[model samples]
Target: MVSRRGTKSKTPGSKRTSANPPSRKQFNPSLHRFQERYEQKEFQAKPHGIPVRVLSFMGVTVLAMSMYSGYLYASYQREVSKAQSLDVPRDVSDRYNSTAPTFDAEVELSEKAMRLGKKRGDLIRLARGDVLEVSCGTGRNLEYYDLGERRGTDDQGHAAVIGCRSLTFVDLSPQMVDITREKFQAANPEFTHVAFRAQDAGAVTVEAPARVRDLAGAGKDASDHRAYYDTIVQTMGLCSMADPVGTLRHLGEITEPERGRILLLEHGRSHYDWLNRILDNLAPLHADKHGCWWNRDIGAIVEESGLEVVEVKRWHFGTTWRYVLRPKILCGEKK
Candidate 1:
């Protein structure tokens, strides 16, 4: 009782003092400063204000697009370069020599020409007797010739002149000539008059005046025998010639005076201005790819070859042209 009255009563709230106790006010101030510093560091680190994943994805997408575009541009440049290179000049004779063996390929394309429409039918209608089919591959058009007349006997064992008397199939390739011979033989085993020759069209000529006179059955010189071919049928053949214009001129020289007809089925310059423009633009590429020279205007060249264009008809809106040309001065005839 005496102690309680003298000393302060001991309680839970009573303040206790320690020699090494932490200072509350100072501790709180230090903690607040640490928190503010941490926030400042975080704000400084996040400068871009975008998520790292989103930025990385965008960067990769841009890089891929750039690479793809570059590849496409490079490919286009390569093709253009190739096209330009084909623009270099090549001699017509050299081109013909290089392309002569490609007749096999041309034959397949000629078959497609049959489907070109009424122009083909019109051409076949104009074809007739003692036919000399140049570039006759596999004898595809030989059936059109009159076999009875060619054989001098009809199916009824009657002699006839209405049928072809002779069919001379000529081509540049021996393989093509052999194939044509077999096809004709198989078709007409009894017809022994069919002949096949592997010869160049540009080289067809009587060697001397005696040979020409014998061939003509006339007392004419080799120059007089220049007018020999009754009719010249050219179907998709001129384009493949080394010098198409020169070839036409030679054909004109060989054709019979006024009697012979030079019939042609050719694909040439487009009539439509827009189409021609496009063709001209793509000529280099097309020629390089196909080994064809689209730059040559066949019609213009043919006309320049002393051929009188009797008819010039455009087939299929300008994809092809069919012409019937007569020589300006027929051989053995005065101009």
Candidate 2:
């Protein structure tokens, strides 16, 4: 210790004595605790253009997905081992009668999000003289109909106008058909040639309609162009039909043989196996709620229908189908 006179002192009680020395930092018990961290798994990790938090999240996601896949596999095995029993048949049309009023509200948002209107228009615009639209629920495609006079002849070589020479709407649900009727009438008050039938499309022998042009008669007979339809259209109808293949075949039989077309837009199984599996698992619940089997093999159904495929296209991982078909009998070769 230095005295006030700045002289060094050797006293035993001096503050600067070697016994106390300079005050060292207070020893912390936690810092002094013994540890054996020579190396660790985390320490081995190094930057490889990806962040550590991202890598951790990726690892967790992979683990969770693996566990989920295993669970699904086990579920499938159990399902396969289960014995078959007589299940009560489902009639989706009956369900549609109840769903008629709010059906558009229920599905419109999702359809708009998916841009389904464009797909519907694509099929509806291809229609020609004496068209039959089977299972036309709530007239969803009515607005899509280009009502301006058609300047061209139909596939069957009949003069056509106002989108079609005549239009027929059919559905199994009376309520649904009624709604369709109201919609069409409100939109096309001047067009009285359109017909609405509340009967199973598969069972009904559709009455041929008078030409829209004939109603005003420019000296033409009402039945001048009366015959089987020049074009048959069904959108999202097959999945709910009890006999899809038979119904398609029936429609083909009623279509004008050589030049008639069947335009269909439907939803079903996907192109990928994984997606198909998911669809199959979800189908029963979907059918119960939406009255449609969304996982049916549409391509297979069309093949079994035995119609000549004029054109076939798919979208949304092949779950959505757009088809143009002709009668196989007269149109022996696809054009």
Highest TM-score model number = 2
Residues 1-335, model 2: lDDT tens digits: 68988987777866753666687899776655533242444456645788889999999999999999999889866653341221324556577878989999999998998899999987898887778899999889998765534676756887755367788899998998999999888888998778899888787665857332222243444555434787788999999988999999888877876568999999999899999987776566667667888888999999999989999999999999999999887433321
- Clash totals, every prediction: 2, 0
Worst 10 residues of 2 by lDDT: 80-89
lDDT, residue 165, model 1: 46
lDDT of 1 by residue, 1-335 (tens): 23656975667787888889785754678889999999999998776778889999999999999999999878867766676676544333233334445645764676576465355556755544545666554455655554544335534777633455456677666776787788788879997655678777766652211112233344545354342555566666665566777778877776654555678877767768877765665567755444455556777888688888888787655767788877786467542
What is the lDDT of every predicted structure here? Answer: 0.63, 0.80
What TM-score should be assigned to candidate 2? 0.68
Q: Supply candidate 2's per-residue lDDT for 13.
A: 68
Q: What TM-score would each prediction reach against the true structure?
A: 0.57, 0.68
Which portions of model 1 show Cα errors greater than 4 Å? Answer: 1-81, 87-114, 137-140, 148-163, 206-227, 284-291, 330-335
Off by over 4 Å in 2: 1-90, 148-150, 153-162, 208-226, 330-335
